[model samples]
Target: MSQPKHATPEQARPFLEAFKFFYQINDASANFFMRNTYPISIKKGTMLHKAGDICNHIYFITKGAVRGYVNDNGKEKITWISVENEMVTSIYSYYMQQPSLENMDAIEDCEILSMSHEKLNELYNLEPSVNILVRRILEKYYADAEVRALTSRFSDADTKYEFFLNTYSHLANRIPLTYIASFLGINLETLSRVRAKKRSIKKS
Candidate 1:
């Protein structure tokens, strides 16, 4: 990740627009938020938040992708992949100020907008509407977490692959297949076979 710099109006628009989807933000609040948040550029393969490190801020992806994963006895177990126009962070660490258990890294070179925990809290206190905005955002995060947890338990690799395709088919050609296989909780060989089967079915 590169050093964060103050965001220009153009850079801040997408971040503000993402928030507007959850809650109404008046001009004053939008201006204040733009002033507080910063822009960062992350190189592919760079770790934004690492295990055992406290996550200091939450990030909004304006471009590219990030993946959340854990090192399980030297193997990577991918938990989630977030693309542009989405929020990405070490949730537990960001909220509780504890060390993160997973790593968040850039899967592709990325541009992101970020606001520190301290600045966010200040917004909550100073602008009451910001509380509603954050609550709505957290609710969506929790719902997505629940869905991911349920999906991870699927026992059939075919069913898992189907679900992944339904949700992330757009990313299939963009990201590494190894990362996609890990995210689906399937071995690479299994994923390849599944893809082959899908292709053959399409041709028939």
Candidate 2:
């Protein structure tokens, strides 16, 4: 039977455990679902999955941060950033069996728990509850992405800045400034100007 066996501490303060149990794992099948996944320790700036690759795994960030972005020629554009208590993946590739146009990379020395797509399919067949859990995770990802799209398309610069700061408060200080600027869809110089304006207002 599958079980979350003897896992090294991924998080000093985990929201739940390996799978982030939203509820009690009362059935053996549910426990099995949890056990099928394993941990992946990623070095800072390492690529978890690269562009044009089939996304064969789903990653749950147990520690540190991850970002999924796309490249245009040599220019990289950050699209998504996930931190502890979150999951990251090229979901479109995973679900549609297509090549991923984005790359998933670590922003820090990170600990991740991942399950192969085939293994998760097996779990879904053995226990349908596992499918529900996967569905919920997908839902959250879509919802967050949709929010970002809406904000970027409809919101003003100040509004976007406020949302970005509110959503990822510490990210500006943690990640490279260039990545942060890209993630916000702002040019580095523009981001610098905005920061300077904020600091000026604060000093006034």
lDDT of 2 by residue, 9-95 (tens): 333235335345543333665455456667768899899999998999887787899998998889898888888888778989988
Q: What is the C-alpha lDDT of each candidate?
A: 0.90, 0.76
- TM-score of model 2 (CA atoms): 0.85
TM-score of each: 0.95, 0.85
RMSD of each: 2.0, 3.7
lDDT of 1 by residue, 1-204 (tens): 966567889999887888888998878788888888898899999989889999999999999999999999999999999999999889999999999999999999999999899998888788888888889999998998887787788998888888877867788888898998998888999999999998999999
State, as a TM-score between 0 and 1, how close model 1 is to the true structure: 0.95
- Point to the candidate with the largest lDDT: 1
Q: Considering every candidate listed, which one attains the maximal TM-score?
A: 1
Q: How accurate locally is residue 199 in candidate 2, as Cα lDDT from 0 to 100?
A: 91
